[model samples]
Each structure stands twice: as structure tokens, then as C-alpha cells.
Target: GGDNLKAAIFSAGFKEGCILLPLLGARAEVAFGPAGLGDLYVTSTSPFGRNRTMGEKLGTGKNLEE
Candidate 1:
């Protein structure tokens, strides 16, 4: 049960990150240029679930503690 819980948490986090990262990158590209996409492809492949979540929240104008 503990392992399942951990897996579920990881899954949810990754899903949210994967969803937000691209959308935000698209917005950046629109506002700036192709470089706005930045290292999206590279970052998305890394095991940075928590980092991605943080980025998503910041990108959406939400507080990190939120």
C-alpha cells in the first residue's frame, strides 16, 4: 500500500508537469521566439517531477507554497 501510494503520487505529479510544461513553452514561444521553447525537450525527459511541478505553479502565477 505504501509503495502504491508513492507510485500514485509520482504519476499524478508527472502528469501535471508533462501537461503544463508544453503549454507554458508554447506560450513562451508565442511571446518570444523559437528559443522560448528552450530546453523543454531535454527537461521533459528528466526525472524532475517535483521541479516540474514547481515550474508549473510559478508559470501559472501561483505561490510556491500554494
Candidate 2:
């Protein structure tokens, strides 16, 4: 050890993995609920993703509906 030094960190910017145990349980409950109705909060990280739709609409100066 150099000068008795210790360095460790866990952060989003550092790309550390987080175990979302609470969120996992909540998501299961939401999926089981009838009102949830398969609305699993989807987003597009691909060309087909609704993200692209939003971006296109934004470029066209049109408001995305839902």
C-alpha cells in the first residue's frame, strides 16, 4: 500500500451495477395488477423504438400524443 491509501467508489457515472431489489418486487406487483395491462413502461433504444417516433415528431414541431 502506498502511504496506506484506499480508493473505492460506486456511482452511476462510474457504471457500477445496482441491484434494484425493491423495484423488482414492485414491478412484479404492477405486472400482476389488472390495471397494469401490459403497460410495462417501454422505451426505444432502437430504430423501431417509440423514442424514434418522439424524435421525429419533435423535429416536425408536432407534439407526440402519449
Q: Show model 1 residue runs off by greater than 4 Å.
A: 26-66
Cα distance off (Å), candidate 1, residue 27: 11
Task: Provide the lowest-lDDT 10-residue window in model 1.
Answer: 28-37
Give each model a TM-score. Answer: 0.38, 0.27
lDDT of 2 by residue, 2-63 (tens): 32221232123122212342355544344434323222222222455565567777889887
**Error of model 2, residue 58, in angstroms:** 1.2
Q: How far in Å is the alpha carbon of 64 misplaced in model 1?
A: 11
lDDT by residue (19-58, candidate 1, tens digit) is 6756776442332333322233334445565566678788
Best by lDDT: 1
Indicate the residue-level lDDT of 64 in model 1: 66
Q: Give the residue spans of candidate 2 off by over 4 A.
A: 1-45
